[model samples]
Target: MKKIKTSPLLPQEFVVENISENEANIIAYPFEVGYAVSLAHPLRRFLLSSSQGYAPVAIKVEGAKHEFDSIRGMLEDISEFIINLKSIRFKLKNDETDAEVTYTFTGPKEIKGSDLSNEQVEIVTPDAFLATLNEDATLTFTLKIYQGIGFVPSEDIRDELDDGFIPLDAYFTPVRKATYEIDNVLVEDNPNFEKVIMNIVTDGQIGPVDAFKNALEVMYAQMAVFNSEISVAAPTTVERVDETPEIKKLMGRIEDLGLSARSFNCLDRSAVKFIGEIVMMSEADLKNVKNLGKKSYEEIVDKVAEYGFAVGADLSDEVVSAVKKKIEAE
Candidate 1:
C-alpha cells in the first residue's frame, strides 16, 4: 500500500502497481481500490485488487456479527472462500475492458413491510371475445416484452443506491430478476399440448389471470405434411381438437392433417376459475381449445373451491391498448 499525502489529513492509500493520483483517491477511506465480499452481516466491506492483469481481485472486508463470537463464526464460515486467495486480478470487469470501479453502500434497512391476505377471494371470467378469433389461422407474434420484467445484470446496481450512509456498513444485493424469461410463451406448437397451442405472455405485466388471458390471441395449426406434389388436408380440420372419436379419426384421414384429441377447459368457465391469481394463457388460445366450456369452468371452480381457493383473471389495460395499436398498424 502506497500512502500519497494529498493534504495534511487527506492522505490516500493506493495499490502497488497503479500509483496514479486518481487511483489513490479511489482506494482511500475504509476501503481500498477493490470491493470486499464478506458473507457476514454488519458488513465490513473489503477493498479489492488484482496485481495480475488477468486474474480475479480478492476482496478484503470486515465480517458481520453482532458479537465478537458471532464475528468469529462468520470468519469460520467464509474461511474456505478466502483461504487460498492472496490477491485477485482486478479486471475492468469480470470480463470487460478497464473502467473506473464505482459503488455505494446501503445501511441495515428495516425494509418496509406490507400486509397481504392469502385468505382473500378472487373472481375470474373467461374471455369469449378472444376465443372468437379464427382458430385455424397461424397466429404469429413478436412478443413485445412488457416493462419491468427483464434480466437486469447485477453489476448494474446504481452507484448511489446505498449512499454508504453508515460507515463500515456493507451489503449484498440479491439478484432480483429471474434469469429465465417470462413464463414460456407457446411461440410454437409443442407436441405434448398439440391440439391447440397456447402462447401466453406472463412476464412484464402483473395482475389478474382472466385479464391476462384476454390480451393474447395466439394462432395454432397442426404440423402440415407435404406429399411432395399434393396439397394439404382440409384447413378446417387443423388445430381443432375433436372430442368425438369419429371426428378425431376423420382428422387422421385428412392427408397432411394430423388431427389429435386434446382436453382443455372452456374459456368463460376456466377464466372464472382463476379470478385473482396470476394465470398466463392468452384468451384466444383458451377459447380455441375444445372442452373449455362454461360447464367445465364451473366444475373447475367447484373443484378449486373444494381446495379453498378462489377464481380470478387479469390483463393489463395498457397491454390491451398496445395490442390494439399493433393490429391497427397491420
Candidate 2:
C-alpha cells in the first residue's frame, strides 16, 4: 500500500480569508471529511434556525375582509397581506417591548415594503411585494415587529400580547447563506486518505468567529446538562476529590462569587480551586495578576461580603486541628 501524508491540525487551522458587509469566508484546514460533514449540518441549522433576527409578526388591516371589498387595492384578502408581512424584514429602532409602527396608504399606486417605514421601524427587504392598487383604494394599518430566536408559530404567541395584534408565522433568521465544502482530498492506491479542507460562509449579522463561538456555547450548554448524569470512576491522574463539608461548601464557578469575566480570567487555577483565596489575596498580591487592578479588587471585596463571606476569613481553628491530627496519623 502506498503511503499518504497529511498536514496535522495545528493552532492556525482556522483562518478568515475575507469578510464583507453581509458575508464572510473562512477555511479550516487539516480537517477530516467525516467530522467536517458532521459539523456542517448543525452549524448550518444553528445559523439559520437559532440565530436571532427581526421579523414583522402582527398587522391590523382596515377596510378588508375574506373577499376583496369595493376598495381597489384590496386585491387579496387580509390573510394574503398577513403572509406578505411575514416575509418583510423589520429592524426595530426602539426597545423590543415597544414595537409598533403605523403605515397608512391611500394606494393610487402599487404598495411595497418600503412604503411601511416609520421612525421606529425600517423595512430591510424593501422590494418585497405587498399589494397592487388602483386610484381609489385605501389601506391603513399598524404592524408589530418582534425579535426572537427560531420560528415561533402564531398559536404559540402568549395571550399577554396586545389586542388587535395577531402573531404571524415569521422566520427572523438573518443568515442568508450557510454552506461548507470539503476539498484537497488525497488518497493512495490502498485507499489511505490525507488532508481535507472545509470552508464556511456566514451572513454579516455574525461573522464566522462569532458564529462558531455561539455554536460552541450552545454545544457546551448541552453537554453541561448531560455531564452531571454520567457515572464512572475517573482515572487516578485526576486531582484528588475534596469530600469534606468545608470543601463541598466552596464548590462553584468563579461567577458564583459575583466577579465579572474580566476579573475572573486573571485568576490562576489554584486560586479558582480554592475560591476563598480570592478574598485572602492581598491588594499587592492581586495587583500582580495580569490586568487585575484596584477597581476590580475592590469590587471583588464588596461582592464577597455581600455573599456573607469576609475578606481573609480562614478555616476554623477546630477544623485545622482536626486536619493536623488526621495528617499526623497518616
Candidate 3:
C-alpha cells in the first residue's frame, strides 16, 4: 500500500492497493481534493521556488507565567516581508516569569527577541526563516500547503467538538508527496479550454455515489440546522447525469492507475464493532474485479456520516445500547 495519511474525520475501512500512474479525469472533485490535485500546475513552481515572498499567520505569545505579572505580546513582525499576500497582527500584555510560555498558531518571527531591539531582517528565504527562531520557546507556524487547486476556504475542517480539525495522529497514514505527470490539459479543443488533473490514490471511504450523495445531503442538512460558520453549502447538483458538466477521465501512462472499491461489514472481530474497507486499486486490480461500478461506489460512500464515521458491521450489544441511549438523550 502506498502510505497516504488519513484525515482525522476519516472512516475506518480505507486502504490503498494496486495503483497505476496515468492521465487525469476532469471530474467535479470536492474543494479539498481538488486543491490537493492542483499541485501539478506551473503556477506552484513559482510559489515554491520564490525566495522573496512570505505567508502571514496569526498566533499567541504568552510569556513566562511564573515570573511576570504581565505577559508581553506582539504581531509576528514580518515587517520586512515581500509578498504580503496577508498580514497577522497582535497585542502584548506582560512581564515574563514561567520556565517557558506556550504559544498557538505562532511563527518564529512572532517571537520577540529578548532584547526587544535585536535587528533582524524579517523577510528571508524559507531556510533562513526557520533558522532564526529561539530554541527555548514553544512555537507553531503556518504550514506551506502545496495546493494544486486553490480553493482557499476561509475555515478549518470542523470536528465533533467544533474545536477544530482532526488531529494528525488519528489518521492511519500520513500523506506523501505524490507527483503528477500532466496536471492541466484542455478539456475541449477551444484555445481557452482549461482542465487540471491531480493524481491521488486515496484510502477511499467506502460507499457508492448514491451513498456519498445521500450522506452529503444529510451532512449539509445538519450543518444548516446548526448554523455552522464553516460548513459547505449543499451542492446544487452532484450527479453524473446527461446534463452534468463534461468532465473527462484521462487514463495514466505508466504503472499508476485509479480504481475505487469499498466493502462493508467485512470484519469478523473488532474492538469498536463497526468494520469495513475501502480500497483504491491499480489498473491491474481494477480489471480483475467484477461488477465494479459507479452505483456501487456511491452506495458505499453514502454510508459515511458527517462525523467521518462509517456505518457497518455490528456494534457490540453494550455499544449499541449506549449509542441508542446517547441518541435518545440528543
Best prediction by lDDT? 2
Query: What is candidate 2's lDDT per residue for 132-176, written digit by digit as tens?
Result: 766777877776677777787766764646765656676666666
Candidate 2 stretches with Cα past 4 Å from truth are: 1-11, 17-20, 65-72, 94-98, 158-163, 185-213, 226-330
Candidate lDDT (C-alpha), each: 0.23, 0.59, 0.26
Best by TM-score: 2
Q: Model 3 Cα displacement at 234 (Å)?
A: 3.2
In model 1, the Cα lDDT at residue 230 comes to 75
- Best first by lDDT, ranked: 2, 3, 1
Error of 2 at 240 (Å): 35
The CA lDDT at 312 in model 3 is 46
Candidate with better TM-score, 1 vs 2: 2
Using all chains and alpha carbons, the TM-scores for the candidates as numbered come to: 0.16, 0.55, 0.18
Write the residue-wise lDDT of candidate 1 on 12-92 in tens digits.
122122222212111211221122111111111111110112211212223322112212222223233233221111112
Using TM-score as the measure, what is the rank order of every candidate, best first?
Answer: 2, 3, 1
lDDT accuracy of residue 269 in candidate 2:
31
Candidate 3, 191-290: lDDT as tens digits? 3222333333211111122222333454445458655566655544322222111111111111112212232222111111221122222334422335
RMSD of each: 30.5, 17.6, 21.9
